[model samples]
Target: MRSFVRAGYNLRKKTGKWELKVRPDKDSMLGRGLLSEKEYHDPVRVFRKAFKEYRPEQFLEFLAEAVHFSLGPFNHAPEGNLIGPYLHLVKMIDAAWLIVERASAEK
Candidate 1:
């Protein structure tokens, strides 16, 4: 069994709505205890290890393009269905950027 820590953040929508997100960090206290001291001490290394699970750089570029296209003034989205996907993309890119920043900071 895995343990996790729940975290929430406010995401503002273009329609003036606030989205509440609950993110799982760990499965439980046991999971926390199971992690090594080095894993806990250097978050950037941990992030890099985890980020390897995804195509971070590619995803970052993809999300940035999606956001640009979706939010562009010339785009025709009168109904605003694109907003949700745009926000999600932004969040993913932000996370990737953070990881990159941390990795650079470690140097």
Candidate 2:
């Protein structure tokens, strides 16, 4: 959850608190008011949707954010998305874990 928020893939927050940082754009379903509040803020749900849709780029974007943090000078804005090492560090598990149910259902 921390990693996802820090990555700002589709959400962000401060002080480890779950808050909405929605930036509705015409390109997103959220902009069309298609996603419920739970769907928009739940990291697992969001990641699952992206993964199931074969959008690996979404993961890359998350990875790029981590890379940007580690290598300060490495700008990811020009690059394209996370599915491996980084996600493991954050979750301490394999990338495949992302597609499965979270350990605890409650956030």
Candidate 2 structure lDDT: 0.40
Each candidate structure's TM-score, on Cα atoms with residue i matched to residue i, is: 0.28, 0.25
Predicted candidate 2 versus true structure: per-residue lDDT over 25-86, tens digit per residue = 53355332333455444434444444444334545566567656777665445333244434
- Candidate 2 regions exceeding 4 Å error are 1-35, 38-47, 54-61, 68-70, 74-77, 81-107
Report lDDT (CA) for all predictions. 0.37, 0.40
Off by over 4 Å in 1: 1-80
Query: Which ten residues in a row are the worst by lDDT in model 1?
Result: 1-10
As a TM-score, model 1 comes out at 0.28
Cα shift from native, residue 34, model 2 (Å): 13
How much does each candidate deviate from the true structure in C-alpha RMSD? 15.9, 12.7
The lDDT, on a scale of 0 to 1, for candidate 1 is 0.37
